[model samples]
Target: MNTGVVTGGWSYVWAAYSLTAGALFLYGVSLFVRVRRIVQ
Candidate 1:
């Protein structure tokens, strides 16, 4: 018998953190590339 229990609070927090980190990284890289292109 397997009980399916889907519930958590930390999982939500982890997801938010991952999303924020990904967005920040992408934004930073895009900004850096744009600046480099503008300088060239």
Candidate 2:
């Protein structure tokens, strides 16, 4: 008998989490640079 659709969820979750964290990190760095430039 075939099981319900719950396989391969861990990889997908990890991918999504990593991408989101990376995007947020880059965004924060961009904001910091802009603020520093403005302060100068």
Candidate 3:
């Protein structure tokens, strides 16, 4: 009955990680742009 439980949980785990990574990527890009403005 619990056959798909592990697989389902893994999908959710990967989704959470992907979302977090995307947010971090955007934040890093914003910081890079801000620093460039200051340096120039």
TM-score of each: 0.67, 0.74, 0.69
Poorest 10 consecutive residues by lDDT, candidate 3: 1-10
Clashes of 3: 0
Candidate 2: worst-modelled 10 consecutive residues by lDDT: 1-10
Kindly list the per-residue Cα lDDT of model 1 for residues 1-40, writing each as its tens digit: 5498756779899999999999999999999999999999
Predicted structure 1, TM vs. truth:
0.67
Error of 1 at 28 (Å): 0.9
All models, RMSD in angstroms: 4.4, 3.5, 3.8
Would you list the rank order by lDDT, best first? Answer: 2, 1, 3
- lDDT, residue 39, candidate 1: 100
Clashing residue pairs in all predictions, respectively, total: 0, 0, 0
Clashing pairs in 2: none
Top candidate, metric TM-score: 2
lDDT (10s digit) by residue, model 2, range 1-40: 7687667688899999999999999999999999999999
Better of 1 and 3 by lDDT: 1
